[model samples]
Target: MSKLNIDQKKIKQLFEDKRSDFLIPDYQRPYAWGEDECQTLWKDIFNFAFPDKELEKFNSDEEYFLGPIVTFENNKKLEVIDGQQRLTTLMLLLRVFYKRLEKMKDENSMRTKQNLAQCIWKSDEFGNENKEKLKIDSQVALDEHKNEFLEILKTGDAKDFKSQYAINFRYFEKEVDEFLKEYPSYFAYLPTRILNNCILLPIEADNEKTALRIFSTLNDRGKPLADADIFKAQFYKFYVAKNQKDEFIEKWKNLEILCKEVFSKKDNTSTDEIFNRYMYYQRALKGNKNSTTEGLRDFYEKDSYALLKSDRTFEDLQNLGSFWQAISIQDKNYFDENTLRWLFILNYAPNIMWANITSVYFMKNRDEQNQLDNIKFAKFLEKITAFIFAYSFIYPSVSQLRIPIYSAMIDIINDKEMDFSKFLFEKENLKTFIQN
Candidate 1:
């Protein structure tokens, strides 16, 4: 790999000379710079190269600097690996400069205008007139790239650039016309200076694989990365650290296994769809309660007890194991059940109804000693689960069936002589109450 010394002129020259050589491919996502970013870049460049000459006006010593232009080798073609934002912004600045020059009748203005025009808007073999025209020629290409520029111009506000280019371009022309009236001089010279002054750092590698590594590192260092991005990195590390890609893949493969096992018995719905619906239900419940569904999906997907195996710590695993142990002791028939019965009951029931049921049950079985016992606690959990499932199935369309079910469950719990069988097994009165 060879090191290339690059300055503003050299960088501008490369862009000017090789318009076709520097292609942002079909796979690359659209330019996403909004008004704030574009404005910030403009201000930063203006402050840097053309610092205030007046001492009183110069407030700070902090120097403004633009980022490097990232390019990759595509055989003889140099693909823009990064820095598309800066390049596109510079292009806009140049266009603005040209517009400003065209307004001036002076010879100097004409000369500067010709220089700027020749740099970015030279005619091609097919007589394609200018950069602006070529940019909007194809809808597919425009949608992929140049739409943002058109949008910033159209709304005169960076926020209103919808997914269409024609709408945005109309605004762009309007903005250019308006901008020329106020800061004609600054517009003419500022863009040309920015194009001729900014620096570019070209990252070179022997192969595309190495270049991609450099590209990834460059991106990682700059932006505020996403949680999903961090998770992918952690996942890669976890795979390498354990040397168990297959094990991880197997775990993911079996993620829906518990869903299938539990839902398969009913045979009324697809387990995958039901599990998705169950998650959506959890989100809705959480949102209804707290106006946010934060960490509910995460809890369902990644934090569930059944997936962790023996790797979970003793304390964490102990609590989870105890819950399952209690369930086993209470229901003796279903040992391998992964169903979180208590959670499901609370989740399915209306908030107020669930609260009432909880209060009644906890009040009746308030003894500290009995509460700690796995078998006893499990029986209470099972009763709640059975109550919820029975109510939900019996009154499938009713929005607030939890009120009646909670009342019945509380009554049954309080009255020792009142048989649970009467409410659950009889089903007719309970079903009628739930339906009504």
Candidate 2:
């Protein structure tokens, strides 16, 4: 494998080889396509295979361009940077075709099955075990689902399988089976068509930066590139600029991994929601009205890289991430009954500016025992939460409360005395902002 290994190959050519392995990295999002996506693909193939007539004739040699896949080949293993969705789904289709052929067991059927199997996996020289050429490599999900996924690939059985991947496989099995009923000979022909006709543009680059640039240039046309992925790449460039690539990568990935778990949809705190909550609080402190109404992207633009020093931004993110993990969910070591009350306030508050403000305070006082006792902190948080809840209900607007609380918190944080009650009393609109 060279530093760059770009190529244009049919699906058959891409997977039907034991020469290299294909892997979707662990950090990438999980397999998330559903019935709608799968149905669209099924329609495309069916329409292309038989344009106007129903099962009239076949052209297995003719190709249908799918799209591009960005990758980097290291040690004969091509890591999929993009386009894993189509590739993984197509692998499911091929698995179905292979099973259909193997059932026939004719001499010709056996040879066809063998060739199609090449697209899915490679057998060991001893022929005891098989390796799937394309691997999803999400260690947890893969470990749980691989045995079942590969079982379906080898045997085509649909027993006790309800995972999204398995469910989609069954869906494809049903659609392809219906099509085969009309054109019974199509089963034998699909392997040839899929291998030779289903096309993809595999652009292998020198590194992740080059591959990400290519990905952005191509896909950014549809969806704007002002999101987290692009922002992450900016940080990567910052690290490279400072000659601290190794340290940045280690810390950044650790934070990303932690965020992924804490902010997963399963946790009922999605990645965006966490960031938005913090941003809401931040804007409130700055007296930014948009904090209550708009998203983080509006305030933290990728082009706003010059607004803050890169290293300071890095440290802020790292510290926030540390505090976030502790208070994210209920942990006995971190969350007490009072801390629980504070969490309830976060869930209850409309603007969540209070959370952003309070979180910042906690980050500053993480090691300070006198000011950060759970019982006292909880009473303080409970007061803010109750006040905001009443005010939001009365006014039905959270945007109004953002500025006052932010100012009060700042005054308190900066005061050597750190008197929460005194700061709240001094602030005008204390009833709507901090008083209960």
Candidate 3:
């Protein structure tokens, strides 16, 4: 929690001399900060160095300041816990500085370049036997650091890096080359001396645990965190507790597979969004027809009924089969996998009208009622079908209307003396419902 005051000179020196003392473990995710983030950091340092000019406004102070440098005491080494992006970017800038200094033949520039190089590239030799352990000579390590620097130079846009920083390295390089052709004194002073900077707040904490915590909280005040990020945090909590990281990952993979197989057939659907939506819908209904749209975005994003296919459990599979059975009785000819899949919505309704029609017929005679006799249920089926079609095709809006429409249809079915066939063909109701 203590603030270590490492200014620009000290920062440059530390990177040049002590860079070999820091090592990023393979456990850390690969540096994925794109050009925009890199440019932003450059702009932040530029503004910090030269705050006088009314430069373009930044989104926030935090955006202007790099978060923190966390130093972790490993068995014998100091591990950098956070701010790797900034640190890596600074190293690239130093490389550029070193190259420019070498071209200039200025003793002062040469001395500064050597100092920066020693800070970033040198390792203290403990003994002849232990030299390799502390040194920064491994091919893998060199390639990674080199690639990190190259990625910044290659990807960063000139306008973003220059306008924000008030100095374009590419432009500076070209200008210096031209000037050296003439005046040559331009190389005597290193650009690093002109750029004032401050080291990020250094936090000392248990390395791995503190890194996760700081990363999570770093941008909390900015745009909301993604669900995937939150899920990863939660997953890690349970995973670490049980020492079942592998098992947790496997379960997530299994859920992903189930989700993909079930919802992939649906048109224009996102699997993750759909799974989240279905979960919300189930919680919303709670075995009742009434549910709110508060979290409905999750389920509506996917075809809920289609997802039933992925359930391997006996009870879930049976419920899915029963749902299809009801759909078959209603529209025998229209009974395809797609139509049957759509029937899962009925399970959300209070009254299972299709199930009721099938039940009544089975009760009347031991033999299944002929399709002709089932004609009496046609009107009931028609009303249900019309409403569903309207909801799915015509309106297609998720709202309170679903409950009322289902409720009205259920009432019609419950009237024992009412003939569904006669009621469905009634011109008045059809016109009224359609118009409304």
Q: Give the C-alpha miss distance for residue 121 in model 3, angstroms.
A: 0.2
TM-score sort, best first: 2, 1, 3
For model 2, residues 1-436, the per-residue Cα lDDT tens digits are 3355667898777776565467765434457789889999988886777776455565655779999888876566776767877877887888788777766866766776776766777657653236443333332211236556656665667658877778889998898788778767555666566667778998888876567667668875443222454445556666667887668667756766777776565432344544554554455455453324554555566355552237766666666666677766766577687687677657756775676667656655556431357776776677677666655655556666655565555654554333334323323554555444
Local accuracy of candidate 1 as per-residue lDDT tens digits, 1-436? 5444344333355555544355453223346566667657655765664567222343343333466655555655555655665666555565555655666887767766766655555456654445443221111121333556544432223445454333333334455565455455544444445545665565545444455455667786554222222222233344546776556434423432433443343432222332233333333333332323344224443553222222322122223223323432444343223334554445555333443344344334435432433355446556666665666666554344543543454454545432345445456866676566
Q: Which sections of candidate 1 miss by over 4 Å? A: 1-11, 53-65, 122-187, 204-207, 223-436
What Cα-based lDDT does every candidate model obtain?
A: 0.45, 0.64, 0.42
Q: State, as a TM-score between 0 and 1, how close model 3 is to the true structure.
A: 0.40
TM-score of every prediction relative to native: 0.41, 0.55, 0.40
1 or 2: which has the higher lDDT? 2
Instruction: Give the residue spans of candidate 3 off by over 4 A.
Output: 1-10, 13-20, 27-29, 34-66, 75-81, 124-190, 194-196, 221-436
Best by TM-score: 2
* Greater-TM-score candidate between 1 and 2: 2
How displaced is residue 46 in candidate 3, in Å? Answer: 5.0
Tens digit of per-residue lDDT, candidate 3, span 1-436: 5323333234643443343366553333234455566556555565554354223332223222345655565655556545655555555455455556654455777666555545445444631122123222111121233343333343332433322222334544454455346535544332443222444455555544455456557645532222333333344344556676565555544544444454343432222343343342243234334434343333322453233323232223233333334453545563444444445445454433334333332222223322223344444445555554444433345453445443443333344342333323345755666687
Off by over 4 Å in 2: 1-4, 54-61, 74-76, 105-108, 123-147, 221-361, 366-436
